[model samples]
Target: MFLLYITALIIVIFLLETVVIDLFIVRGVKPDFILIITVYSGLFLNKTTAETIGFAFGLIQDALSFKQMGINSLSKFLIGYSIGSLRENILSENVIVQCLFTFIASCMNGIIYILILKGLFYSEIEVLDFFKDLLIQSLYNTFLAPIIFFMLNKVHFNNVREFRGRKEEARTD
Candidate 1:
C-alpha cells in the first residue's frame, strides 16, 4: 500500500533528522524536511490523507523530542487541513503556489510551537528573536520545498485519492 511507503519515508527522514542535524545545521537550524513533506501532502493529496501525513510527521517529532505531547501534531494537522482545503481553489501544481504556501505553513508551524511553549510552560521567548527564527526557518523550508516537491511529483498522489471522488458523467445519464 502507498501508506507503507509513507511510513518508510517518515522513519527514514526521522533518522536523517536526528543523525545529520549537526552536520546540516545552518545558523543553528536545519531544513525542515518533515514540514516539506507535510506541505507536499496537502498540496497533492486528499484532505484526510494530508491531515494524516501532517499528524504523523508531527507526532514523530513530538515523541522524539520529548516535548509536550500533541503540540507538533496539532500544528501540523491544522496546516495540512488548511492547505489541502485550498487545493481546489488554488493552482496546486504551480511552483510559486507551492513555495508560497510552504512559507506560510512553515511560519504557522513556528507560531504554533512558540505559542504552545509560551502559554503552557511559561517559556520566555523574545518576540524579535522568535520572529527572526521563524523567518529563517520559513525561508529554509520554502527554499527546499520546490526541489522536494519536484521529486515527489514522481509519486503524484493526487490521482490516487483514498476515498471515491465525485461521480462521473455516467451519473447524469
Candidate 2:
C-alpha cells in the first residue's frame, strides 16, 4: 500500500513537472521533482531506506527524463543521503525549515547537475547557462517546496502512521 502511494505520488509529480509552471522559461532550467522527493523521504526514513529510495527514484527520473543518463541518479542519491544525515543534527521538523532545506537542496542539485554535465560533455562549458538555470530552478523549487512539503508530510508521515496503527489494530483484532 505504501509502495502504491509512493508510486502514485511520483506519477503526479512527473505529470505536473511538464505541464505546470514554466519554471525554466525565465532562466531555462530543469527541475527534478524526484530529487525533491528523495530529499524529503530521506529526512523521514532511515539511512538505508532513504538511499534506496533515492537511487530508485533517481533511476526512474533518469529513465523518464531526456537529460544525460546517471546524472539524476547520482545527484538524487547524494542529496538524499546528505539531507538524511543532516536531519539527525538539524531537527528540522518545522515546515519552514523543511522548505528552506528543499530550496537549498534544489539549488545545489541544479548547480551540481549542470557542472557534472558540462564537465562530462564539454571542456569549456558556458557559465551563463549554468547560472541562469540554477537561479530559475532554485526560485521555482523554493516557491513550490512549501506546498510539496506540506502535502507530502501529510501523506507520507501522517497517513502512513495512521495506516500503520490501523494495520496493527487489525492484527490484534
The candidate maximizing lDDT is 1
Evaluate all candidate structures by whole-model CA lDDT and list the values in order: 0.81, 0.71
Over the stretch 32-138, how does candidate 2's per-residue lDDT look in tens digits?
Answer: 67766776776665666667777787777788767657877788788888887876556455667777787778877777677787788664657887676677777
Model 1 worst lDDT window (10 residues):
161-170
TM-score, per-candidate, Cα-based:
0.86, 0.76
The pairs that clash in candidate 2 are: none
Model 1 over residues 98-155: C-alpha lDDT tens digits?
9999999999999999889999988887978988978988998999899878766655
At residue 109, candidate 2 shows an lDDT of: 76
Rate residue 30 of model 2 by lDDT: 61
Q: In model 2, which runs have C-alpha deviations exceeding 4 angstroms?
A: 19-30, 123-125, 157-173
